[model samples]
Target chain A: MTSSAMQQLYQQIILDHAKSANGAVAELAALDADAATAASAAGVRLAQSHQVNTTCGDEITVRVGLSGTGADARIDEFAWRGAGCSISMASASVLNDTVRGTTVAESEAMLDLFREMLRSRGTIEPDEEVLGDAAAFAGVSKYPARVKCAMLPWVAFEAALLQLAEPA
Target chain B: MTFVAPPPAPARDPSDQTPSDHAQTDQPLTDRSGSDLTLSSDEVLRIRNDFPVLHQLVNGHPLAYLDSGATSQNPISVMEAEQEYYEQRNAAVHRGAHTLAFAATEVFEAARATVAAFVGAAENEIVWTSNATEGVNLVSYAFSNASLGLGGPAATRFRLGTGDEIVVTEMEHHSNLIPWQQLALRTGATLRFIPVRADGTLDMTAAGEILNPRTRLLAVTHASNVVGTINPIDDLVAMAHAVDALVFLDACQSAPHLALDLTALGVDFAVFSGHKMLGPTGIGVLYGKAELLAAMPPFLTGGSMITTVDMQGAEFLAPPQRFEAGTQRISQAIALASAVDYLSHTGMHRIRTREAELGRRLVEGVTAIPGVRLLGPGLGVERIGLAAVDVAGVHAHDVGQFLDEAGIAVRVGHHCAQPLHKKLGVTASTRASTYLYTTDDEVDRFLAVLAEVAPFFGVSR
Candidate 1:
């Protein structure tokens, strides 16, 4: 077997990010703690969303904290903890790195772009400047089944933001 | 990660297949299969060619179709039978008095007779349903009707009331589990289960305690889909019968791989899907003792099933037709009969012998890998041609992907038996299920690729 198609799904970059959430230790630590305990992270407004891919039993809980309010709000950081395949784990790490400290609007826009590129099935070219390490996932779009694994954390991030909007 | 990824490694020739490189097999996996390992590679290649789908390449590698436990591929003969039916006789069975209808009905009933003979049952004893799930629901609802006094004094023997009990095993697929659960819930009968041991085999000692005289029915699988354990059905049947409890054998997994004679098994009723064997989907069989079926109320009631009808009420027909209330799965049933003929011609004992060899190779090959943990019986134990394994630190989906990239199609996840997964202490597993067509080269390659998975992901023992 030529490992080209397989390698597309398991790029070295994905393997690197998947093995190490080194850049996102704070976020990982926050996700590991109880919500109430993690809530004590200064003045940041934190919200959490947990998602599971029922078919393969992959689970992820993403926590996004916003510092500013409404239209001007900024995503302070992101953290997550769960168990899944490398695509899912790497996607979570890459998403955490790409979206941290960006404006809430910008993060959501990036999420939309990543989602759109993945749904494009490699038709819409991924912009490296915009997607950063996430452009590697453009190849993931080829596999319709694995697309969900890549999107699991991004969906959780969106859910976390919407969860923050609720009348708590 | 804060650090940047290094350049991608040049693509390695995945075809440079390494033998089971690990010495874990020295622990008796490879050496133990003395005679079972004698399935000639030449014979397997011939069988593989019979399946057109098996000859194709998936992702640039030869396809090793190992998910037969999910659904077996149709052979050319089964396909021809279905196409012939559509080409020549496509009319509804038992409906119009036209020549086409007459021909279709005769052929359809002949198909019934073929399947009936296949399972050592009388032709009148087989009832058609959409699939095995529907088969379970049909009997459960028949009991529901009986409990409501729908079939009058005859169904009294089948009815359940307060304090009555329904029993199943912890290992049943949802098809068998849910219908009985709903039946118990509706009729106020208590639902109970016989649990499995830590090794995934049924605890027959516990089964003894759970199945008491109040047990009105005992539903169980002939073999477990998840663990591949060929259950001890005869002893269980005797236990259930000693107390006058009716038995429903789930033959979905066993029907295709094993030589099954449901009548000899002595279960009061049984269910198996046609698609799981070498046939088309949309057809399944429900076998019952003729007397039981005659006494029970029909689960579905409509045109073809009725003897006579009025505004007030209707008299249902007898046995098989009484249960088949809609337009029948005519072509599918006929194709299934052809599949049965194919299996019979090839010889079930021969198939069973071949599968036993493949089954051991699967168990041995899988268990010999370091981090890959085989789910069911270990080496030297009897199981069907399947093996489900849990890869430590690597999710089942990843194992599936790694195997998929190598052109090995397998089943991954909870496998619709979450309760059994819970008992096995894993959230999900990767299952490679073989059939009459699987070869040793495919089994060996699967093991080799599986060994690569943990190392590829930087997970080490």
Candidate 2:
């Protein structure tokens, strides 16, 4: 029998999400081109950030698309491409699914809550309504070495969002 | 080569034993008909008791330490050596006129002699550095200084310019590769590497073609930290010498396992870390031929390494002292000498034979499992007692986690040889390395745990 720790870390939902990440990555590539075309036609802005975990050489490039202006803006699209352990890939998949149609403020709020939970070291109980499928990652917070794996995608997401805030 | 099980007795005759005798044995110790020192299973079990760290449980299982390539566990004697130095005779070496200072200086210099003899080099030829990385950097910086005409007339041979070239191998750890890369960048010289073959060995054809007249220096690993394949140093050294180029060996992996004779190898320079050889950290050895070191400039400057200091300039000491500036890792050095003594007493020949047997067992067992790809030379090919493998459908980190839960500690990453991994078409791999203290049961446990990894991850054959 698999230990509870192993089962908790590699939950069935996380494995399912990771297996579907390839199709999501392909969709992200298609959206990259669409965002580039849409940016010129409308006032839409797109930005991408690439991050690498030096310890294991896992890498991710997160692309974020913003529509409308300032605080009223919403995340029109969210996508990523990378290869890593299940935690990192599943987190990227979850980020794409949860934040796509939400306002930029709502996405940022979710990101803040997610970061807090990861840093909680298994102390903070995750809110299922708030995190959606990402709540499955609460077990990852217990492993200090693997916390970075769960956070790599989110870190890349924040960098992409920062790029969207620039004047150009 | 036949399977020659060495005699049950310890290898060396106790009367003829000397520190340098371990590395100077010319006969291939594996000859089936001859008497060779090989540790029996019971002897290895006895040796395990020397290392206190090995007697522990992790995750409710007996700890199987197979990560000696990363850093070895210290024996009680090695730890006590350091502690004894601090307790009884702790003083700054090569300075002061007090009794403790004299005693400390004697102990420090004695350690140097012991380490030098272990590697078959003269006492004056070994220079102390913080670690192997720093040792490589020391030589690289000296070359940089020489390139700028810092060491004066004798250093001209070390100089490099636009037309000059530096050659390394794809299998080098970043410590060896990056320093040469930066050196080439700084001096406007071209940097090149000998490609790795499909079977994870060096392409000697490429090496011969690339090491031309313009090649000023050839830096390569004595044994690959990732692949565990020992290079043909004699052939490579001869090739480099034919073109009048200098050779530097990264001996971090080889020195601990092999009977290293730097003098016999005829390399211009070599470096090894203390921690990897059952010694303490914060101390490493850089072995340079006397003539080469005398010609090279100093890398660091401060107290205890100078002759005279004027307001305008400071005259420096020669060779080892010149490179070793400031206060040294005195206690660590004393402890490393103890480590050398420990290995010497156990006999390197016996250690090598036993490890070779374990290596064969590990390679055969790991390769037998479906979906597992061994990274280094194939079965029956000679390699250091280590194996790095990639699972078909699993990431290295996941495999590592699975093994850790079974109380088996192994290194899982690029093993600091990223270019080699990139060439092999893998992001990372799992490596299990053994030392003198590693036992048969440990190797068996590692193999058993590894077999379970794929099935646990639901990977198909």
Candidate 3:
């Protein structure tokens, strides 16, 4: 009864978020204690931080590193693991991989494009080659409420950027 | 006067009056018609024994009911009232000259009088509907019909068109909100709501802004079902009246706890449920001002509600009979009247006082327990007989489970006020409600069990 765009919002991205969150402590629990602590400590110095989806408790811990030689910082390591629905976990995993080599400015640009795509705010066509695996979530932008679940990680990434500016 | 019991002073507070106190229990209850006031603990306990559902094991424990806000346990007298009517006088009322039909009609009309006297509304102003939801919808539907000029002079009272606003509060139940929304959608009217303050009270400033000259009707709850906050309706009523806006009260929560005087309150319409007032379900009462009732169009039609029928069209009967269409909930209405009699026998003042005491105890006990955050104001005295709390770091569903295992029943989730809960910064909260039948021992047991379970659930100080 609803539009295909609406169907896309409830896509695998949100179902995955609810079913298998990719950055939760469950994944951390699988790692060696030393490695987990190392990752957490490494993240503490980064301007960006982790944020949890309160509605379903999915989380994403984002970290950004500036090369000092360039105007934009590189996403040095975008590793995440959590317990949630498959779509959320898969989306978080793919997001971490996709943003790793991308510059801070491009990431910001992509984040803008991603939000618009998810909301069906207007006509948005994601470049398949550039969007990579994140494009699998293109259909998910249709469900207004579910868009939050798909975009939770990206919002955390933005929050991380703000923190970078503040050095917290 | 044989076995002279005191005259039941329907509105008087008996605590300060000594002579009336003695007469309350002086007369033998054998005569059901006798208006008694002094119901002792033993007698009240015996009366409780008559309700079969009260004695039961829920979740492998003695069911300590703490959710009367959802619904009340009905007594035998009320239950039998329905059966008695069906057995003896089950025919359609306000029609037919047969003896059974006349008797049924008399009983039905008398039930209306009983409910009217209970809420201090005139008998002719009472309209029976399926439930409180229907009662509210009836008014909205009637207003929509009236705006279309259906009931002539009566229709003029409800005429709302473009620029007319329907005022409600954020704390309204969905039953109260959705109908007004649909009415607004149907009419070109605007639907506005008063926001809740930080402590769950109405944001009067927002209310003032919302209820201006454009406001045609104001519908709000007398109490919050989730937060347990008794709203300041007197000010709201006065404010609506200042702008000549008609006021309709959703008395679902208040009817069971506080004594209501609809006429004295000066509200145009008041709707409440029989089931919530310790009566049977499937019956609700709608009290409209006599003039307004005379003017409003009938919501439902067909059968006994007709005055004179012709080939072209039909003239409807007066006030209640006009509103009531098809076969009524005859037994349920009679039983609801009997429930009113029960409340009268207990004396509402005494019930109110006792529940306040119980509320205080419940709040104090819950507050003393670490990690329990009381949600509403006036810990015990500040609210009606309900209390809601957010147990720190624990999901409300978990808290509810822990309490259920302790033999204490509570309501969880957003309590059908999703937006209100979101505003209060919680997805859900646990609530325990009290009633006239609730005792001090039950409150103590609840506290003892909560303390024992909170620790087990890793809830720390």
Best by lDDT: 2
Please give each candidate's TM-score: 0.88, 0.92, 0.69
Displacement of residue B328 (Cα, Å) in model 2 is 0.5
Positional deviation of B118 in candidate 2, in angstroms? 0.4
C-alpha lDDT values of all predictions? 0.85, 0.85, 0.73
- In model 3, the Cα lDDT at residue A20 comes to 44
Model 3 lDDT tens row, B247-350? 99999998888788888888899899999998998999998998888888988888878889999999988888889889988889888887888787666766
Q: Which stretches of candidate 3 lie over 4 Å from their true place?
A: A1-168, B1-44
lDDT order, best first, reads 2, 1, 3
- Name the lDDT value of residue B318 in candidate 1: 90
DockQ for model 1 equals: 0.49
User: Compared with the true structure, what per-residue lDDT tens digits does model 2 show for residues A25-81?
Assistant: 553453366667878477667888888999988888888878887778888867789
The regions of model 1 sitting more than 4 angstroms off are A21-46, A166-168, B1-40
Provide DockQ values for all models, in the order shown: 0.49, 0.51, 0.02
